[model samples]
Target chain A: MPIEDKQKPQRNDRVTIRTVATHAGVSVAAVSKVMRNAYGVSDALRAKVTDAIEALAYRPSRAARGLRGRSFTIGVLLIDIRNPFLPEVIAGVNEVLGPSHYQAMIGVSDARVQLETSLIESMIDYKMDGLILVAPRLPSEILAKFAVQIPIVAVGYHDASATAFDTVNADDQRGAEIAVEALLACGYRDIEMLSLGERQGHAVSVVRQREIGFRRAMQRGGLGSSPAIGKIPIASPKREEAMRKFLSRKDRPRAVFCWSDLDAITLLSLAMEMGVRVPEDLAVIGYDNSPTAALGLVNLASIDQSGRELGQVATRALISRIEGRTASEHIFQIPSLVSRNSLTRSGSGTDMKQG
Target chain B: MPIEDKQKPQRNDRVTIRTVATHAGVSVAAVSKVMRNAYGVSDALRAKVTDAIEALAYRPSRAARGLRGRSFTIGVLLIDIRNPFLPEVIAGVNEVLGPSHYQAMIGVSDARVQLETSLIESMIDYKMDGLILVAPRLPSEILAKFAVQIPIVAVGYHDASATAFDTVNADDQRGAEIAVEALLACGYRDIEMLSLGERQGHAVSVVRQREIGFRRAMQRGGLGSSPAIGKIPIASPKREEAMRKFLSRKDRPRAVFCWSDLDAITLLSLAMEMGVRVPEDLAVIGYDNSPTAALGLVNLASIDQSGRELGQVATRALISRIEGRTASEHIFQIPSLVSRNSLTRSGSGTDMKQG
Candidate 1:
């Protein structure tokens, strides 16, 4: 490498709009509009400015913008910020946002429609450029209507209603089947499941698809009678109480697959309280592979959908939408089952049980 | 309870920006500028506009402003999204942000300096109003310069200087002493410590204080004759290979305290690989009480600085700074130990001599 070739480029310390305009052969006002993604730019001019920006590896100075349009904030409204699964998804969102000059601000809606409504209102009030909703329980009408105004991505909702915002979700049915298959492979026959109930009776709802898949997998395995399902209201931590009735039954399930690791953890704690030995009298598997599930006492067997991957996809969807793409529908991400110590014995008397 | 009251609220929703502008006797542009937090607004006019905004409950639609100044996004950057300790800090942050009408967008920087720098830069470029950096590893000079331009809260860094940016970190020296004392109380005379090296000599870094605390505790206990500290670079897994040399030694300590639960986990995993029984052969203690430390197989006894509480404190500090609190200095958070299964059965029988 010659010294002349490697010489420092001209001082573009704060790459000025003038430099870009000069390079692209356009007015500074035109360049400014392009930077703001404003209207009235010819497609050819936009392309020329963009190409110049890339070629120069230009990074616009946010300080000079004076808290104006270039602060690169991406708003993330989590249904529940404490929910273990959302962390991974946010991580994935960060992966996409990292390169695109965006940072995410997260809000915990606590799965309340009203709180979420206020939170989104606040995000909009604050002027976030983009928003992501994780497994929101809100009506699709609100989401669809909102999409017309701001770039939005909904994660964990599989069905793509044209009106609802762009979506990134797992094949809940396939994930459910995989959960059932894991139990069957471990020699389970009487495997039950626990899940959340659908709010608006949509096929795209994760809870509904997972429940259906569980039923289908059981039926296909020659079990005419479907396994029992417990659909309880979320945030009602009476899991120990609710699970007691199921555990006290005569024909109990050898294993129970839960929709979330939190429930399974509660169940395990409850079972221990009830003196039910794990992987002996009963076995438990859960979803989300939550960080809490990996805790020593919980050690839940879970399905790994990689919420981060979902977040990454959803972010990409929103970026695509932000970039003026006209077409976006349902995006079904795949989920994998992580075989931890939580799920081992199945259908009773299986020696593959972990130490 | 009557529908009449609801009807009145619906009437309130009818209050538009134009209505506020007309009421405040200002041009719509002036109101818009106040709403956008743009410069050049006189305090008197700003107060007048703000009063009108509050009275009318005039919310600027996120849709219309989607292309304008306020993206309404707040960014949270963390070293790793998966750290079990962070949720609590985030929980606190949400508590503060939720009511103040700010939404948080989180990015996982994977504890990398370059990644964190880029994430911060990108967030700034996108128009984020403020940022919270959790356990960041960037240089102070870079951070100081960045803080001069943007509102930043640096959590988990204990800087002695009045500080260029707001910071919150635990008293690691005291925290380390508590761990040592707990182990000493358990009668572990020959105790060892597992820690990371003093990398890059960052004054505000955590490990250095922890080591000082450990050494001081040993000296206080009259065990400073041979301070057995095992250094490991957890930044890379290859360095984990050092655990055996310390574990298999003839003069091995009966109880070992670690810097973090991750270190404890790696030690335990290596112990299992080396066929060394836990608690029975050696007692281990760790810090952070990370979810992984509490797993079924690795019930590590550790300190809980409460990442959640730290996050809450840091958020409050940042908010104070944003609200113009010029007198505040760096905050040193206190920590408490959470003893679990790892720090058991030390100084009994011939544990140390036998090893």
Candidate 2:
């Protein structure tokens, strides 16, 4: 066979809408109207068309359906996939969409701003009914411009003032405050926070929000108004190097709170290798309460903010906006602390066996 | 706005292919021909259409494009998202597709057979150029049936005999043999393999292939012909419970090879809680040298398959099929062992600091 001929799309004999119309003894127009639930479709005609669709096992082409109207597909844009917390959110979204007529298609941006923009535009061009962006890198103005093209709900983005799109978040400020409060309750006066280092820090980002909360909580607890906040590089060798430096600091705080479990877990491992006993030498608390934190070998204290719950809420919000109830709802869920062996020897945390 | 009105799809004034044609002072067919790179298109006409598209920022509707020909989209189906190893595969796919016009959309089936079938059908209906299914649960015949409609490349599935689709895999049988040989070299005469407790055992599955290799290597080493292969449940409570039971067994082997890092890491945690020291009492080896396995706290010895490389090879094979290849291609990559503390104390493995 010629290569040019092979390049042509392969044709498959499938049950089309026309086949359903013929089986129902109705015009193609009537069948289309009934499938769309358009006005002026008689009850008898709808019943007949529905029965024909079922009997023929006809699946309407998503492409044609998208061109005419709704595709029943939801686009999910993820900034990164390595974070274990993101998968929990996806599971929650799947739980809600499993029985519905909708399906989710995910696009990973790898946290690149350019790729993120193109993906969002591609989803809009696909005629997807709605989109759920988790930890998107775009600014609020850019997101608002795109929101005009489709119904969008963002998770982990702390933009409550935006009127164009809905936002669902686990209160990062409160999460950080809880981490500090836990350390304070343990009688640790000198405490510092370890946060992510970004080239350009956006106020709307979760990292900044946690920083704000960390400062306020420390001031309220009678610590210095400007408590020490260490910056950890997000990538590999540098990230580990930063953690090691923190561990070797002669004036390292008595207790430390990490912005995320991704970093805190690594810090614990480095601490162990450096002969720094966990609670006895340096008390540590982290955020996100990831599955790894609960392991018997890595019992790091953490703040519990349910990623699944955030996903469920974002999906519901997006659905509402797609259904025409859009008033730009911004929802927040409180995060609590999950104490473990890293906090203290007899910390009142859940037993490792259950984890 | 009324509730019913809100349910209607919102209208957006997106630039269309027709707009590009108008801007280029050419017919829609001429612009479409240029976009598709169809034969008999003049270079002058193609250049004009391309320039017009750039100036107008016109993105062709994916739905309309799919209806006429290719959507320039590749669909990726993942069995589960929680597994850390899956992300590496996605990274590999994205790396290859980054500079090309093609984009990838992922669908998570959560290991459900029914959902996997529907997602594949949906991708076909969308007129996606090709598909990459990772550890799909469908039978070979069913996949072959779908293969006629679209190009498909399956990762982690061991179906080299199927003529309809391509497959990419890490040499699972050899991977298991390497693990056993490593154990033997460590002077461990007693050993066992922990396998997944699935409802149905398919010879094509990677799990069963590992079992075959495990038995062969053990027998070759003068061990019993029928070596003990304990089945570990795939889910949470049951999975942990099985590990605990194995840890408490009085006649447990001196060393064990787990089917995956997911189970091996959990087993290591259980051993720690049960006061059974690693390498000292229970040497463990796992597959899929996942990030967690390399962690200092985990330090699990595992087979290095390089999921990223598998994903890259699979994508290249799928693109070849889409472009014109007809013959089925089954590619394999040899896996090696990454010795760690879990295998033996002072083992000839990479140091924990580097990990």
Candidate 3:
């Protein structure tokens, strides 16, 4: 065979709408109507067009369609990718999006507000169908302003009163409360919370919500209104330093609840280095129920909020909003506790001996 | 401000390329030439157009530009998101792209070749400027075919013979040799390797390269050419089962080398569970030296390849290719061993006690 004859038909040589119309012996408008599933298309015309499409293996150009309308691409903005919890959310998003015509394009902002803003703008400029912002650090009002340009569903954001966008959260306050209650149930009287240190305490931040829950649960348990809450710096060096200081402190609490499993696992390492035994000298509970926390060596008790489920719910909500559901929905899912050896020696339930 | 006034100055009120041309008192073609940095644009014209752009805060629509030409966006394809090593590479890519006009959009292929091919096609369809595939599973010929359509730089792929695309990798064979040499220097003659089990071993894969290095190093150290190499399943239940089986085997080697820290850390946990002590009963070393390996409770000795540096180099190479660097460049960096408690009790250097 000649080289030209042997060459297979590539994407450039693909069948177009015109070819489908010609093959179906119908006008281009009729084929277009059938392709869009418009109301005016007759059953006979639809069947003819569909048969031609199947025979010709025609795939409409997404870029060309995107120039005119929806791109069928959802942009997912992640604040940071280092956390293991974020990958779980991505898995959930992919799970929900796999069967649909829609596809996801991810942008990592690295927790920088400027980069996050630029990424959102770029997504909108690309004419994406919708966006899912996972644990965004931007204020609610700013998010509301952006939501006016495109449909948005925020996962891990705590805004409930916003009318422009939907919010899906794991109920961080409830998660923190569960963590504290588990620690209290384990018969620990001297307990404190280790929280992320930030310049401002925004109501929309999950960290602040967790902190609020920690205080409320502590107060409800008859602990003083001013229970100790140590702040851990977000940077690695300072984060380790603060954990070390806490471990070496003479007045360290009998039990501690960390805002995230990332920090709690580090605390476990530091405690081991400092010769302070878990559940024997210092008990620990963390949020997020990360995979590392489940390791036999770490064995950390944690609050499981299920980031994957949050991603699934957020993607569904975003799709609905994109398809013209205007009313804002603020959905919340309660979290539960996973008991491990770090909480108590039995590793089954709370041992009710007072500290 | 009245709501009507606020609404009037929304999307439509924003500046555009035509507005920039008008503000600069230049022709639209001249402004376009200046934006593209095409020839025949005077310095004065470029300066005026830039000033106008800065004054109006005009950002050219990426979607509109994508229809005609480059989108100024780079696509990053990750085989899997769960591995900690992949994130380091992303951090490096982001670091290099942060100061440039290019932005990275990531796609998770979930280690499936079909998904990887689709994601690559989607990026090309989107008219992205370039692509950086981290540890892709695609064959060299397929990648070369895709290279005809778009610029590609593959990190962790070991195909230096390919002429179409650039590859940046840590010397995996040398990395394996370093690990084996460290183990040999500790005077352990009975050593084995735990490698990933796949349906077929491709020469382009990093795992296959590491295996070759492991065999060569074992033979150089006067060990028999048929040294024991255990194959570990990649999936969860079976993976652990394989490690547990190896740990309990009466004829197991005195020391072992693992393909990755992900498996090594798990093996350590299972070793503790099975009443086998590290270094005393079975010395172990791993690759990648991931952050988890550095944890005090799970300090596994391993080779450090610096995935972040590989990412940075790959991004630079991709950008250079996108900017018209035609020659295919293959870059390699050497990896070193990080001694830890898993290899010896001292956690400083190898304990040269013969076994």
Candidate 4:
């Protein structure tokens, strides 16, 4: 009949999981286990506990909740923002995570092993839940071994064995085969392919793979009668000069295939400066469907692998691993095709053929 | 003696700044103040503290080290990853911060206010030292007021106030003038321009300024008899339809000036679908030296703004402000010009005389 006195003071503003558990008539561990949605809880109990949580309007501190893992943040290691391929990959990763509560924080390593290592250490120091490394320069074995101890995924990498990491690629072998086949279809024999480096690494540089595929396709077609293979040193200004040597030879190949859009661009610039016409003086094909390839100045024929798809698949793999799904290593590949243009022949010189 | 004592037991494991401060007969604040190189510490005292710190090999904890407020991480909010301008800007930012121990983390808001707000909040949650917002859609009042509370630098923004933020922007007015004048030089009187929606409340959007400059330049060139303007509805798939309708008019313009490279792309697509040859039926020009504009399929003649320079300028301003420089609201009015392309002149019947 008598209402209790109403001047009850609040103890603390913070709402802990323990309080929610007590209010829900359950153990604190049960509340936390429910909060994390950890295994071994009945659906009925989880529903009851979550309802109570909603009623209390409980907001857990990220710091306290993050101690056992799951910072809800994904660290992205991008070596070069200027790579042009990265933006698509990043977009794919964002597409994968945007709807979820996870956030991405990107750090640029600029291709320096020391800087990449430092960036990784800093991300680890900050306790990011997972990481996505795009085109890292570190030794694959070292990276793979390090990845086992940490939740990580690799994107756009072709060489690393997947023992210690999850990876998503564009099927470099297939992509190269497609590019080379397109060039072969154009009836161009005696092709010269410009690689990032002959010694850049293994046959997986995507660059290296494309070159091997070209060579194999040429061999299959018996088009390598003259065999005029050349390589561009990585990050070298001599790339253009070396390209010039390939272009000016008295018996130059009738076709040129480049492993990168950047290489294709250099070839185009050289062609223009030397007064050589695209698809006429030489037919050129490039990889990476990079935005540069679409430019009117170059109009290079290139392989169109989806960098964004690669990023999305890698991110999904990392998140799945973080979610305690099947661990170990996983690889996902996306298909790509050839984009016809000024540098791609259509039987007639200087024409974009369409059926 | 020291070797024997060290072998027995080393007292150096816990040589934190706190211990060093006590040993140097100084307050913890004094040690921290010296570490930050802040004012109010005497030379002799700093020397004494430095000697003691070296002697103890004291390492300051990152959490406790920045009581005066510094996280050494810069948060950058970009418009969209699809836009090539941003990655170029980030490259410049990295150039400045690479050797300075400052790291940049990017979040793409994609020109959305709510998303931008969420991104800023996420950066804050991560304890970022400062922030850089590139072409945000939020009002200047909200951004300016918020900037005072936090160290924020605006890029590609033209707000003329120092209340809450410093601004870095290209000379868009000059850029528009160049775009129009180039068309005039190519013998075109009826030059139509496309623009994004010019929002009210703040003269922050460079699109608004560019539009104004385009109008003024057309007027100055005596093309006032029949001025042309087109606005593309955002999130609309019918952008080409709008451009096609404009192009198909009996009194169609001889030249089309695109506000951005993306708009130009839509116009080019529409032209192709409509069977209107570029530079023949209509001359096309775009702004922003986007890689898409350079593609052979889309060799759009357009204005070039140094995204790399804008990034460099913004980073320099932020670093200077962090170092206690009094300068604020620094304006960057970089030059703008058009790149010559296959689309500079109208081809046949649609070609108009330069009035």
Candidate 5:
């Protein structure tokens, strides 16, 4: 195909290095050397290869570049694709990478440890420049091991002491404390927490961090040192059944703090179905302040962690690491409360106090 | 690293092909040839390479395989990630790929034509085996040109006349007809549609197909050939403002059908804020029966297109094409209506009639 054919709408044939070499009347190895800017190529050979490449519109394959050097692609591994929070993080990563030469390719692990490990290995095998793992299911030690092979920045993972990789997170402890404080401010004395019933409670996991924060905040408020924390199953049917049982319990608390808006929104829906009024029958506050929580029908008060900011910070950290930074960095941003109808009848604006 | 070192939790050194060659007392080219199973490699050479590979735990890079042959990875391009419906499609794709050796890598185009083109080209340059594009923004001619380079299966695009690629849809026109019929059955004569204000009115888009169905169904019911179809802007602030304007219109129809659950759910929220009672003051129907529609608080009646099943069918079609079936296939699934509070006061079950 000639250069003019490149502009045709029906053109589909890819111009490879072989086509460039044939056009330049040179061996394939000579063309590869010139393309790579190898030391031994003469000016005349370079000009011939360059002219042929321009004329043929021969773009080098990213796979070939991956084998030799940088492919200019960043790999992102998400533990779950369904979480509304994860998409916000992706939007942030894309915003920072939009103008640059680098592009992002994402892999979903479905929150399985084995799948997460394989996806990480595959990204490494593809020779991606760096990785951004969002709420990975892998343990800290395993993540550290992967970090040595490639640049890594973890979002929503709470391993601040690790020296192998970087970590970016919203202060989960503070977020939970704010949730509890907001409920207390509204004169709720009897309060409880609804948390995820995770299979593995990795201390570095955000759920565990929130639990610790919940306990400490309850204790500081002169409530029982071991305040009630109810476990909610992650999957459905059983998830809804458990919530229904809680709603029907005779000793149910007057107020509740949920670990996530994912569950909090569901609880509100079930409350409406069961004839329980929010903030009237059961005051509730949740975390992650997802878009759904702000709906006029839902209006659940929540802690705003800002997943987008976490993503932006993680991407910048990964780029700095790829650019030759040696020391590992740990970053945190403070989370605030978004008071709404679920917290109090009058709750409707931002509450910025650290509490 | 030796094979024994692979068991260590902290060992991170990667085993390269050079280590395998050194262990086998052979040249790197000999190992590469044996790995590729080239015709010239004798049994003895293959045995030596195999033994050394086992002892050193050397895994060939996927990038290297991509340059020569299959990398066993499928690329999925999503136009927008924020839409909750897209995740169901991804879930379906993952379910089919879970038992197979093939894996999926996703790229989000965020509805930008330039980014969509670049991502598709990048996927081809990466030497991925095939592609599945969900609601892509590219033109038919451009997609056809790309289809010649690699096997492609498009979901939610309605170009049945194209021979270059396969398509899987949910019979969007039929879905719209069902919506209109259901509304008419419930005694709603004043009906309208709220569609996206897209920059390009591609005939292949589902929105346009739905418009065709809506007009036909109305004319068939003795209404005018052209009915009121409100244009809703896609971005926020503007998106919300447009919906609010439509809700406040003095001539607002008694019933409305939205192109997607995304907008319909938002409209429901605005109606609640503006003191409009669902089904009493306004009846609404949405497409893509997303999870949010099922929430007890939302209870939005919508067309159930089954995005997950669409994803599964598209994956199967792409794989068949990748295995060398040249004839293009355009597959479609019938959509149904899920009745809820938004449709009418008594709407609470599945309406299976395909009007």
Candidate 6:
């Protein structure tokens, strides 16, 4: 085959709106209106444009469309990709987006505020229709500032008071309370909370919210005036060291609630290494019922916030905002608990109904 | 703060090549030449442009740049994100690209070929500078066709004969041989391999390469020419069922080599449930010595193919290709074995130095 002839099928011949217009014997504006589904286009004109489009197999170039208007692509910003929970969120976002014309392009920020800001800026520059930021590290003020430029729906970020952008969360505070309640029901009075040791503390963070819930729940249960909460550093070696110290502590609590499954699972592993028995020595519960927690080997008790559902809700909110819904919606889903061997010897705790 | 005033800081004022030229007291063409690092530019001219760029703190708009030329962003296509090994590769790519001007945007194809093709097309339409496809499902001919339009570097894909693109991989066949050799050295005469069951088998897949290595190693060891290779379905329920059936088999092999740690770890979990002792009744080793493999609890021996290193090499290769290194290069890195409890009762196996 000749090179040109061979390449002809692969190379897309540009099918402009003007081509559709000419084929339909109508003005270019008419075809554009029909494509956009504008209010002005009549049914007859729409049918004609549709017929012409079908005959020519007109597929508009996203890049060209992006240059003018919406690109039909939603950019998802993940704070960290290493966490198993994040992939579930991505799956949820993809599920909602798969059927629609919109496609997702993911950017991992590695939890750096600077990189997160830049990725957001890049998405905006790309003329993406909207953005879904999963557990963004940026402050509410900074996020509010960015939200003005484009439609944004932040998942796992707790800022209901913010009027700029919408937020869809799993009620981290309530989730933490549920974890504590599960522990309390199991007759574990002495309990401590393990939380991430971030340099700068922000009230908008889910970690902070969980801490508040833990404190409140402890107070409500009359366990202690002020329950001790251990701070686990995010870096390696030190993270394991903190968990080991906690495991071997002389005055360690009878039970513990961890901020996330990422930390909880590690704690479980280290506990096993340290000759500590789960539920017997240290009753444990974690947040974000990740896949690893459900493993027969791990069998960890976890609070199920459903990251997938959060992603789905956030994507829907972003789309609605993109469609010009001005009123910001702060959607919160209730979380439940999944009982397993980590909490009790029976390896079955009270199963709460999923919300 | 007033919304309009708050947004002022973020709304980027476009800085064109003309602005840089005016500031540096040079022509726009000289600025473009300096930006591209073309041979005609003098040191003095480069210094002037650099000074102006520094003074203005000018960051080029990727979208506008993409419309005209390079986007300074590389798109990474992942077949699946759930796999733990994939994240290490991403980390390696980021480590290399972090110091450079290029940023990475990832698209997950979910192991669907149609989705993979469309994602690749979208990246091209977005005008990405290059692409790094990690274990892509696309065939060599299709990939070669795509390579004609952009620079491509494939990791975990075996196509050394292709002249259109570069491939960076760990010697998967040799890695499998090492696994079997380790098993043989432990005096395990009867051995089997568990491989992913794909609907349409492709010879270019990494799984096939590993299977070929397993067979060759078995034959070389004076074992039967035709070794029993079990097909484990990729999905859940069925995957676990197959492993359970194998574990319960009366004529089950004394030892087994799994295609991935994902499967091997699950097999370990199932064996524990079914009361099948590791290294006593059945010995097992897996590929991709992932973090999970290192856990003291699930200490399964595995082929140590550093995904991060593969990612780094692939990114470097891609950058080279993008920078006009046209001759297709195929790079191979040797993989080593990390012996653990699953391989033997003592949890010790011959350790080879990693390449």
Q: Best candidate per DockQ, number?
A: 2
lDDT of each residue in A196-255, candidate 5, tens digit only = 999877788888889999999999999998999999999888999999999999999999
Candidate 2 overall Cα lDDT vs. reference? 0.90
- Which has the higher DockQ value, candidate number 4 or candidate number 6? 6
Give candidate 5's error at residue A2 in angstroms.
Answer: 43
The reply for model 2, stretches above 4 Å from the true place, is: A1-6, A37-47, A347-355, B1-12, B41-43, B347-349, B352-355
Better of 2 and 3 by DockQ: 2
Per-candidate alpha-carbon RMSD to the true structure: 9.5, 4.9, 6.0, 8.8, 6.5, 5.8
Q: Would candidate 4 be rated incorrect, acceptable, medium or high by CAPRI criteria? A: incorrect
**Each candidate's DockQ:** 0.21, 0.46, 0.30, 0.19, 0.40, 0.32
Q: Quote the lDDT for B106 in model 4.
A: 84
Worst ten-residue run, lDDT, model 5 chain A?
Answer: A1-10
- TM for every model, in the order presented, reads 0.77, 0.95, 0.91, 0.79, 0.89, 0.90
Q: Which residues of candidate 4, in runs, are more than 4 Å off?
A: A1-69, A198-204, A222-228, A233-238, A265-275, A291-300, A342-355, B1-69, B185-187, B197-203, B233-237, B265-281, B291-300, B323-330, B342-355
For model 2 the local lDDT of residue B19 reads: 71
The C-alpha lDDT values of all candidates are 0.72, 0.90, 0.87, 0.71, 0.89, 0.87
Clashing pairs in 5: none
Worst 10 residues of 4 chain A by lDDT: A1-10
DockQ of 3: 0.30
**TM-score (chain B only), all candidates:** 0.77, 0.94, 0.92, 0.79, 0.88, 0.89
Models ranked on DockQ: 2, 5, 6, 3, 1, 4
Given candidate 5, what's the lDDT at residue B111?
94
Q: What is the TM-score, restricted to chain A, for candidate 1?
A: 0.76
Error of 1 at B32 (Å): 7.2
> Which regions of candidate 5 fall more than 4 Å away from where they truly are?
A1-13, A16-58, A347-355, B1-13, B16-58, B347-355
State the displacement of the C-alpha of residue A184, model 1, in Å, after optimal TM-score superposition: 2.7
Retained true contacts (fraction), each candidate: 0.22, 0.69, 0.45, 0.18, 0.66, 0.38
